[model samples]
Target chain A: MQQKLTVSQLTKYIKQLFSYDNLLSNVCVTGEISNFKLHSSGHMYFTLKDEHSVIKCVMFKTYNRRLRFKPEDGLKVIIRGYVSIYEAGGSYQLYPEYMEPDGLGDLYLAFEQLKQKLEREGLFSAEYKKRIPFLPARIGVITSPTGAVIRDIMNVLFRRFPNVVLKIFPVMVQGEGAGKQISRALDMINKARAADVIILARGGGSLEELWPFNEEILARSIFKSEIPVISAVGHETDFSISDFVADLRAPTPSAAAELVVPEKDALKRHIMDARIRLKRALAGKIQREKQFLAQLSKSPSLRHPLDKINQLRIDLEQLNKRIENAMERKLESAASRFSVAFGKMDALNPLNVLSRGYSIARSSGKKIIKSVSDVKKDDMIEITITDGSLMCSVTDVMPGT
Target chain B: MDEVKSFEDAVNQLEKIVELLEKGDIPLEESLELFQKGVALSNYCARKLDETEKKIIKLIEENGELKEENFGQEAQ
Candidate 1:
């Protein structure tokens, strides 16, 4: 100012001062947020203020993605970042790297944040869950090598289904590197194709002890497993992130074993019942067939097959007798008609006149001489009787008056 | 009673035979054959159940090769 420095030069000098100050370079601020605005470029601009003062804040998308809760106006929060001056505006603002709700612990907030994120992504949707195998040939277990959880599971599984194969993958259930170990075991199981189904299990413990199960890495691994996963973590009341991501959830490790396989005695009873039903069904089928055969045998056509032929023979004989009687009547009527015609012909016969001693006289040329005028004196004549003919010459000529 | 057949297969076949017989429309000779096969399958399943014993084995990686060891009371 004493040298009459330009406005841009003064702003540059002040920006360098804020950037170079170690205390101002990194800070933790606790205040109520106000006038929060998230730009289209994914950069957030807000004002963090207390009763006495306020400071401008900006969080890029890179840092905003790391925040667990939604940042809004009037919400009290803690921000850890550094102060930087914007040379163009000549204003210093907090560039936040991390942010959290004021009253919540980091772990709790992280859990909620991850849960909400995965829920929104549909990872925990019912449609994503695979159906657990009814009869798994091999069951893969991921848990502590030496623990009541494993022992209880083994005992229950062996008791229920003795023939089922169980493969245990020893893993650290809690503490440092536990999440990575659990995740690796799942990957190994899937890669090896060692089991038909996987059981992710742990005994009852406090929230801190059960932190590995809540890890995002383990949850994603369980969600992406090719084989169905049954999560059995802690007591009935204890719920973990694995439980929500798994295909099936059992209250305890022993309960998981029980749910995985059917009881041998129950299966045996079922088979026996099936056998009984099979026998009954077969017997009923045979009985039905036998009745059908009996009914067929009792049918009239089959019982007396020749009866129809006998009736047909009787009908043929009656027809033959009627035909013979009709032919006899026709011959009798024909013979009587012939006799009637013969009697009538006999009455017209000229032989009957000859039988009564009558004769017909004819001239020599076969002409009949009915009177003496037809005959000349001394002419020859023929007289015909019924059986004979006579030739005679007339001795006297007489004319009939 | 094929040795290679699984108990589950045997039980499934037995159930199918029962269903076939229950329909009551098959020839008598075929029904008899199915009944005989069903009886055999039932016997095989029962024997399998009675004869099976619990076996627990542990898988270990030795020299990058998976090996099986008998897991018994000693581990417990």
Candidate 2:
């Protein structure tokens, strides 16, 4: 007979046993998940199973917080942890610390890992790859001959830039032998070397549908392509190895064409703008030169090289002649005054006056009486003539003295 | 088409022309030369746009060989 113990005591004993279980702490278990239920409380409960075995597993809220992908039923996962008993239920289970999809179940992880590896290798470097020609004589497309990817690309390229020469290199984009077809298309086109750039595209699909682009062979081919490759394999969220290896990765097939060719409308506008700028700049330069010439031509030195000096000389000569004439006139006037005074003195001399036949008389203390009445009173008088002095008598006098 | 060069070569040449013009130090004679080059580049770009204007109809395989089909309009 066994001794019965209280439920709490039994639970405590089981909890202590689980804490000491070293083998349960860290373990790697791979099996299909079943009975999967995620509680609203943010905890995950499930069972791990294979052909004839199953084990209860619990991913608690804390550990589940680290999961990058949502867990679902029928998914095979590789869990890390050991089997431990819950004290409250006395049930034994695998308490997972971490989990990953079995056999690389997450396609996104594979895509990311490949992307990172390729990036580190510099396969997608802009330096190593050539840019798409601004004006391509021809653009070659490699995709499924009948898919929206090609149509979208074509429509956009046509709408944005019309009259583009597109050569389609039809190939299978999915399923068996897709990698081969794509590789063959690339090889053939490069050999022909007709197109300026190559665009490889496909519509968005499930992971299986996009598997062809993930093939290592296809990625390698894109890297080695002689013509620049633009990979537009799927939607924005979907990425493949081809995307990283190609010269450029576009979010969609339409976007790839946009990258490959220049838009007609935008290009036209750009050309117009460039033309305007060129003309403006040239005209501005020419205008500036003309203005400079005009300024130089306006200078007085250039306009009248000799006239200014000649005019000054003429003015100087005129001033000099005027000064000389004024001085001579002043001297002549002074000489005229002196001559007049001399002439007067000469006239006053008796000898000069006699030549003119004129005479002058003056009454003295002995008066000369010219009239008969004056003769009676006449006394000694002096008289003067132009030639000589003589005793004189009074001459006949008019009435009314 | 005769002006067509490698994409990288053309882009590099275009960049050089832009730089020379931007410096504004070129003589009038040299500036005219550079302007001519810039015109050629713009023309090349126009030609590229013209080339893409042609239509490309994507096709899908209904049986064995691929056939042209419209997108979002059909179920495969």
Candidate 3:
């Protein structure tokens, strides 16, 4: 016959055994998470399960605090922790020290997850990009105080622009606290309202050296900054989360400075060109008005004042010539008509009748002797012919019916 | 026309004046006014460009507050 152990005593023995086993103490478990829940006490209670078997797991608050992504049901994850038995409940459970997504390395997975998360939140959308100030009086630069970045930036900026202030906010470019330092610098620069535009820059390095720029905290800080940010992190090939979040991205810090300011000589030439254009435009306006005045002078009415009067005078002279010609025509017709009537009158003339060899007799009183008794008494008579007159004495008077 | 607030505004306004003049239909009086303002704005922008002294500064924390100083003079 076997003696039975109490439940607590048996569980305590199993917990001790789990702790002593090296493989059980430190193990790596990969599976899909299910029944995941975070307790109010900050412990994550979940079950890691494969196709046939499931393991109960609890990640205490301390370890979960380090997670870059929140664990959820149905998420495939690889966890590293100790497998220990809970003495009170008499069950074996995995106490995870670290948990990460299954497919990618820890940092890269964190970047991808944060990128997806922020992208879902619309941080990388085009509309969110701020317009960099034109001719910013103070340009804020965030980089290491001692590096080729700051010096190269200064050199490019000085070469391109002559009339602006460059304000550099130095921060550690890499390592554990670098993200925090950069985030803090952004806040401080924003708080003081020191700069109109900020350029966050660094040189090229391995993925780990550029890790700080990929941090979600730095990305969020850059997105939150009211001032426009230009991110110039690493070489052209290196892209960081800050590059996506910043308003502008430059291939290099030197390139950032070049883009940030207008070229001084080019600007001078621009101003000069505008001035020349102003002068030319004014001259053109004056010239156009002058031409207008000239055109006005050339208008028909004002051009030649005497032309209308001259035209009227010529018309009046032509009209007078026509009137004289009409009168001459009327006179010629009247004379011709008078001549014809005169010819008819000539035909009816009494003298012309006498010219036809006709004769007449007359007494002294010029009475004609037409019968024998017309001249019986003392009367003077005359005879008339076509060309002459004859006188005769008559002793009697003649009367006839 | 408003006050020339910055080099950008000044240049932008100058460009606008140039465009107006280019149309060549504006009255003489208005053209003259635009020309004068344009010239003045051009001069203002030039003077602004001239006034900037190739300045570089850095921020340092002296207690809890951030303040500015000349950029580290190592390379001048």
Between candidates 1 and 3, the one scoring higher on lDDT is 3
lDDT of 2: 0.74
CA deviation > 4 Å runs, candidate 3: A1-4, A298-401, B74-76
Using DockQ as the measure, which candidate wins? Answer: 3
Best by lDDT: 3
Segments in model 2 whose C-alpha atoms lie over 4 Å from true places: A1-127, A307-401, B1-76
**Full ranking by DockQ:** 3, 1, 2
Per-residue alpha-carbon lDDT of candidate 1 for residues A63-156, written as tens digits (9 for 90 to 100): 8975645788998889899998887777888998988888976567667777887888887899999988756778888888786888899889
Cα lDDT tens digits for candidate 3, A249-269: 999899999888888899899
CA error at residue A375 for candidate 1, angstroms: 9.2
- Minimum summed lDDT over a 10-residue window in model 3 chain A is located at A392-401
lDDT of 1 at A376: 89
User: Which CAPRI quality tier does the interface of model 3 achieve?
Assistant: medium
For candidate 2, lDDT tens digit of each residue in A1-401? Answer: 89999988887788777778776666798999888999999989999999999999989999987664567788889899878777677788899988888877565655665666677988777787766666675787888756577678777776766686677777889997897778767766776565678888899999878988986668778888889888998899987888878878899898887787666676576566766776677677777778878999899988898888898899989988899889889989989998999899887786677668755444564453355444334444566665578875544444446
Give one digit per residue, the lDDT tens place, for model 2 in B1-76.
1354554455456556665766667787888888888778767655544444353444333444444432343212
